[model samples]
Target: MDSNWGSSSNLDSEWEEHRRQMMEEDEEDDARMRTNTQLTATAATLWTQEQIQQEGPWGGSVVGRSNKRRGRALGHQKLMMDYFVPNPIYTLENFRRRYRMRRHVFLHLVNDIPNVNPYFRQTTDATGNLGFSPHQKLTSALRMLAYASLADQINESMRMSESTSIENLGEFVVQLFTRTRMSTFDNQHMRT
Candidate 1:
């Protein structure tokens, strides 16, 4: 009976010591977590302050665009056809025969069309290469109208993407309609 009591007393002392150590470890873990949380909060606050200082009061620049060419620049290369004759596709004789117009008339159209539709203007890209020039756009439209060619077929020789060729074709039609309407019709309508 005395031996059993001694063993129980020993176990009780060891258990109490272990419990105390576990509690200390738990407290240390809690302190470490609080420190980490505070560090994270401080970092986030600093980041926010830096962002505010960088952007000034509100987002976007107070002044206008940084330069004249600010945000305006072509993003793709589609104007290579500006002076490309396409060997046999767009030769002088072929153009005249296919479009049913003289070379001079075609040239005149090319010059005048871009005056009305700014979409056909030659654009300089930021990296390199100028996007579709007026002549290329006009040629694309003319070929589409004359040959009833698909955008894919036109893109093959023009070096333009299919979507761009289609978009240019649509713009070309609108400009042509405006020109034809102004030229063919009287400025003042006749009163009934």
Candidate 2:
């Protein structure tokens, strides 16, 4: 054996074995590093095939788009109020006919109860149109009780959700109870 490349057969064999072992370890480390990098990159999205089909829900569930949703005009067309959902109750006739309540009584509710202010107040939304008004909520509750109608009927007339009508009825009833201090009916009142 040459003195330069191979000093002795035993020493050369040991050096070659060490080199081979180091190369194997380096390959294993590289594989591990590549796997870790891939895992870290995948952690950000973590999207599965099923999740991809679900239309990318971050925190919210996939809700169906409403056909009756109000929006800005298409090609500068005027966006008018729809046939349903009354906005302002300016006249007594209009107020009474829709909500089955007199204009003065409606006004009295708005003025008397502090909580009713929040329930019936006209709010300005992003589009600057008067969003859900207090009048509408009151009307929803009244109509639901008067006709024993479902929340869907209130939803159509008020342009809100069935859940909202149910919510309004619950809140209206609670507030009415609190404001009037009325609890259980008198035994005499319900006597046959």
Candidate 3:
């Protein structure tokens, strides 16, 4: 009877360890699901797959036709000149003429697609009008958000350490834009 009691107690201990491991795995899965759900909800709010693909360098895992040349670094003087030029209308018009695309299309791409300025939300009031400068602000915000998202996904899927995953994520973001022939032009920073 004493031996039987000891064997039963050992079995109980083994079952407890198994139960604990299963619980831990289940908790981790739930946490991951919650994170994924939050990201999905955020993505649904702002961008569609088509917009993400066409708007910037990260083109939703597909390649598009674009020139494959390294861009020249713009000097501070050049950036200042471009910003302080005081001819938003003229500059936009000149750009449209050069591209031979409709001005409205350019406006849409800049304002809606990139929507770089963190302050500016989608405005229903402005119809066919461009209203922002220093386009880099908006593009930077978009890029950072994308990089973070991709990094998180990599960490989760690959089971990499956090720091390593983040470093890899940065490289991945750079490559995402660079792999495309149009990467130089699509990335606002790369545009000379």
Candidate 4:
């Protein structure tokens, strides 16, 4: 009886000790988490302060600081001379081969797309800098589609950013599909 009691008491003490160690470990983990959270908050505060300092009250200068205008007008001129002009540098066969479509069809799309979606329309910025023309946006989108090329591949030739190229592609696809669907519906209704 005495031996059994001694063993039970020993077991209880061992269990208590184990529980105490586990609680201590949990407390240490909680402390670490709290410290990490505080550090993250401090870092975020510092970043906010830096940004506030850099960007003045008006904020135009800092906002425009990173925007690099990539001479889109020159790119548009080069594109026109290369393909869209009456006596273009590239022949009809070259245009067809590169664009995977007839020149007329490409031009028709360029002409019609701006009517369907205003995003294709060229506009001037607040600083009176001309934005990318419809021709440039469509050409970039078509090149990406025809070549299965990455958006960045069009950057140098098209004078647009990778993100802009991707955006143009997405918008082009959506607008084209919309136009096609509406035309198809009209045709079906007319036949009916």
Residue-level lDDT of model 1, residues 1-192, one tens digit each, is: 999999999999999999999999998997797566556445434543454455455423457744223111231233323233454335677656866787678778777766777787787656574666676677776777667777778656666655556666667665554554564355335432
**What would the per-residue lDDT of candidate 4 be over residues 73-98, giving only the tens digit for each residue?**
99999999999999999999999999
Query: Which parts of model 1 are misplaced by more than 4 Å?
Result: 1-92, 184-192
Model 2 misplacement above 4 A: 1-98, 113-117, 124-130, 182-192
Q: Which structure is stronger by TM-score: 2 or 3?
A: 2
> Which sequence of candidate numbers ranks them by lDDT, best first?
4, 1, 2, 3
lDDT of 2 by residue, 20-128 (tens): 9999999899779755644533431232223333534332233785445632122012111321225542454755775577767865765665354475565766657
Against the unseen true structure, what C-alpha lDDT does each candidate score?
0.61, 0.55, 0.42, 0.80
* RMSD (CA, angstroms), candidate 3: 21.1
- How many clashing pairs per prediction, in order? 0, 1, 2, 0
Model 4 ranges with Cα > 4 A deviation: 1-65, 184-192
Best by TM-score: 4
TM-score of 3: 0.26
Better of 1 and 4 by lDDT: 4
Candidate 4: lDDT of 48? Answer: 38
| Residue pairs whose backbone atoms clash in candidate 3 | 116-138, 117-138
TM-score of each: 0.49, 0.43, 0.26, 0.62
lDDT of model 3 at position 4: 98
- Model 4 error, position 112 (Å): 1.2
* Candidate 2 residue pairs in backbone clash: 120-134
